[model samples]
Target: MEQLVFYSLGLGAVIGALGVVTAKNPILSVLSLLWTFFCLACVYLLIGFEFLAVAQILVYAGAIMVLFLFVIMLLNLGTSEAADFDTARAMGRRLPLVLLVGCTLAALSILAAQQVGGTSDEARADLRSVGSLTDLAQVMFGTYLLAFEAASILLLAGTVAVVMLAKRERRKNAA
Candidate 1:
């Protein structure tokens, strides 16, 4: 039963990821990402990490998704012009490379799963305790507090840089 559930969630995650990749519309891609995040939360729940699951849903599925939608709307990307892409030609050129990469990733994932699956019941108990909300909070606010703040600062700097570059390009085009 557990294996069945795990496979189902895994399949859903894969499908959601494909949707995000294949959808031409950014909004649709974001919605697909939301589906993927929800499936991730479900997987966390199945693994006995209730706090992590709730945090995933609340942070990624709710707040992050809302922010994504807000930014998409603000950008006013109402219509996307079709790219001058030759799908047949591009597919012919890239098919082999894509297939090779996909196969490699699949093999790696199988190997990783095998390695983790070899863990004993005792290790799983430790993982459960280590992954608890209190432990996570301590790590984030105690041990890694400086690192966490630095990451946020870096993200803010990147955002400002992008906005400035966009404004500069807009002004140049207008002039």
Candidate 2:
């Protein structure tokens, strides 16, 4: 049952990722991206990464997707014509080949996951203990504090850069 669910979620994630890449409109691409994020959270839940799953949902699916949609709306990038994106006709033309490739990739992914996840019960328990949020926090703060701080600073720098770029465009428009 668990393996079945893992495979299902894996397939959904793959399809969602393909949708994100192949969708014509940016808004549809964002929706596809949200599907991918949700499927990833489910896969993490299956692996017992409760904290990671919740963070994925709360951070990426909730906040980040909202931000993406807001940006799309602000930029007015969602008025794409249907004639420009005839996905159904394309899929109908190449349906068999696409299905063959998709199934092949999905099978490979499941096999890979099974091979990687074939550790003994004891090893898995040890990993769970080490991977718990509290244990992870201790290691991150105690052993990798410098790297963590550096990453935070890098992200802050990126945020400031984006804000500056947006304001620069606005200043020009106002002038």
Candidate 3:
């Protein structure tokens, strides 16, 4: 069961990564990136890192991706009629990079798996200690309180900046 979940998440990450590179439309790419984050959250879940998984979903998938989509929509990036795919150019640029990144990630995963070996009962116990939402809230509001507050402030600033940027420009007529 664990192996099944690991393989599924690995495949999902690969597909999402490929979609981010190969999708011509920017909106599609953003959606792919969202999938990538979601797959990562799943990977965290498979390892019994429940708090990390929920944070991955809430922070990256919920907050970050929504901000990305909003910025993309606000900028109106893909509306130009002249924008079209240059398949040869895209393939030439992206293929080697993709292969290199994939190889590196595979190597790292293998190395990490070898180091961690199989899950132990001890590890499961430790995971359980920090697994619940209450445990997460305690850590966030206790040890990591300052960092959490800073992140909220940053998000607020970003929201204000986006609103200012989205305001329509006024044109003046010549007298």
- Best-fitting candidate, measured by TM-score? 1
lDDT of 1 by residue, 149-174 (tens): 99999999999999998789778898
lDDT for each residue of candidate 3 in 98-151, tens digit (9 for 90 to 100): 799889998998998775567787876775667766778898899999999999
lDDT of 2 by residue, 81-102 (tens): 5454567786688889978998
Clashing pairs in 2: none
**Candidates 1 and 2: which is better by lDDT?**
1
- In the order shown, the candidates' Cα RMSDs to the true structure are 5.6, 4.6, 5.3
Cα error, candidate 2, residue 71 (Å) = 4.2
**Cα deviation in Å at residue 117, candidate 2?**
5.9
Task: Give the distance in Å from residue 57's predicted Cα in candidate 1 to where it truly belongs.
Answer: 1.7
- Compared with the true structure, the alpha-carbon lDDT of candidate 3 equals 0.82
Residue pair clashes in candidate 3: none
TM-score of 3: 0.66
Instruction: Evaluate residue 155 in candidate 2 and report its C-alpha lDDT on the 0 to 100 scale.
Output: 100
Among all candidates shown, the one with the greatest lDDT: 1
Name the lDDT value of residue 87 in candidate 2: 70
